[model samples]
Target: MFVDSFSRWMKLYGMRRKSDTLAFVQKFLADMSGTGVPRSFWMDNGGEFVSRDFIAFCDNAGIRRTYTAPGTPQQNGPAESAIWRVNKAGHAARLEAPRLFPKIDFTRVPGFGRDGERLWRESCHWAAGGFNRSPTKANVGRGTCV
Candidate 1:
């Protein structure tokens, strides 16, 4: 499973840096499919999780998609825990490298634009490479499947 956090920043003049919600989902599925299709997925009811594109992808993949009820994150205990861990790690990384924050150009990220347009293909490439190698607590000593 893949997990990550989405952040939104408000701006006064130009378009706001709205969170890139679909990026995570698309990346997650692509990475998982590289190995094999999963039987199902459990997620929260966030806009990203419930998007039409995500639903269609799951349908085409023959993967069952389950959503937790509103305000009841406990229903998706594992996914919630994974998200919390990722958020904590991201926060720590930011603290360690303060300058890295300014380098992230949201407009350049892939699977992030409207209507399935890809912008940040490079970022997606890097993330996929690293994420597929990172060990996970869920898998214990077993490495992640690419």
Candidate 2:
């Protein structure tokens, strides 16, 4: 997910593999939200962001990378906080799926295991996107962001 520092726009992606970051970011860069390649990326020291393909793409795009100190996520505070908020909302939204839409039995969804992880993931996506677009005290009077 790419959380814009200024707009707090959270791009929640459902990735099946860690390497999917490269593809997702590439697609994101081509989308309307990506007006221009960001000058730098402040990220965690995660293997996904440090993968060879991701590194190569960032190098070619001239996007500088800054990793937070190991074990210290607060270095990237705002993004982390936004992620927490989105996750909390997403979890609640997923739990309320039955109540909100009783007709669909998540456990019985096609192509998903009885655990319903995929179904919950879809709910998370919807909930996060809605939270992203909702009005916020921090964004008052600011122009729209994708």
Best by TM-score: 2
51-109, model 2: which lDDT tens digit per residue? 88889999999999999999999999978887787777766766666677888876776
Q: TM-score of every model?
A: 0.50, 0.80
Q: In lDDT terms, which candidate is top?
A: 2
For candidate 1, lDDT tens digit of each residue in 1-146?
34432211100111123245455545555654655666777777778767788788789879898888899988877556644544454444434332455575534545434322332333333344444466655455655543
After superposition of all CA atoms, the RMSD between model 2 and the true structure is: 2.7
lDDT of each: 0.51, 0.76
Clash pairs, candidate 1, are 108-120, 109-120, 110-120
Model 1: CA > 4 A from native: 1-24, 97-146
> Whole-model lDDT for model 1 versus the true structure?
0.51
- Residue pairs with backbone overlap in model 2: none
